[model samples]
Target: MNLYAIFAIYFLMWVISAFIMLPFGIRTPDETGEVLLKGQADSAPSNFRPGLVMLRATILATILFGLYYANYVQGWVTLDMLPGYSAAQ
Candidate 1:
């Protein structure tokens, strides 16, 4: 629940999320013929790929950061303690 831990988790999650989404943006699109419909996104593998990638990456980063931040402030999730140390049975 400390600020240090929160910051660490946020930073770690952000970097990881950004890196993961980076690949989706870096992939080049093909010139294959496809049917286009109205109101559909035109994400061709062109110069605009990187920008779209960045946008997605940022959104993913936000989500990751939020999850990490929440987890950081959450209660205990482990119970590894043992019981019954008596000698007589």
Candidate 2:
């Protein structure tokens, strides 16, 4: 894929993950032997965290895209480009 396309895809992915996905519920045990659930599961150490999810997705996408593009020279997974105004005219 082209650089811009890859960037835009990652940007969109991040936005979706940050705004669309709901927060996960946290489950933990308190000192009193009771389930002490705090904020979302993304309480910094929670396994399933939503905080900075966009950052994570963007980073993952960028890395994968870079790897794939670097290894593939045939543009197998390249981004598709549409005709411009000049071509239409």
Candidate 3:
């Protein structure tokens, strides 16, 4: 793949990873028995950590991107393997 395509794929992976990681380590004030702020929503996480989430997302994205690149190089899967896909269309 070209450099730009690689970057784009990596960025897409990172975004998906970040979103997937967002809810894993979260804890609401009620869940942790902490006092909620005056204006804080009940569902808002009291112990949200962006740095940790970003770190986890980066690691996961890197691994996923590596696998994706390997698949691209190895041709482990192709469009024909997917149902309803036809190149003749």
Top of the candidates by TM-score: 3
> Scored by CA lDDT, what does every candidate get?
0.59, 0.53, 0.95
Q: 2 or 3, which is superior by lDDT?
A: 3
User: What lDDT would candidate 3 get against the real structure?
Assistant: 0.95
What are the clashing pairs of model 3?
A: none
Higher-lDDT candidate of 1 and 3: 3
Name the runs in model 1 displaced over 4 angstroms: 1-9, 25-48, 76-89
Model 1 — which ten-residue stretch has the worst lDDT? Answer: 75-84
Candidate no. 1 TM-score? 0.46
Question: Distance from true position, residue 32, model 3, in Å?
Answer: 1.8
Candidate 1, residue 57: Cα displacement in angstroms equals 1.5
Instruction: Summarize candidate 3's per-residue lDDT along 1-89 as a digit string, tens digits.
Output: 89999999999999999999999979898889999878889999988899999999999999999999999999998888889997778
Can you write out model 1's per-residue Cα lDDT over 39-80, one digit (the tens) per residue? 545664443465666677668877877765565457333233
Q: How large an RMSD does model 3 have? A: 1.1
Ranking by TM-score: 3, 1, 2
Sequence-dependent TM-score of model 2: 0.33
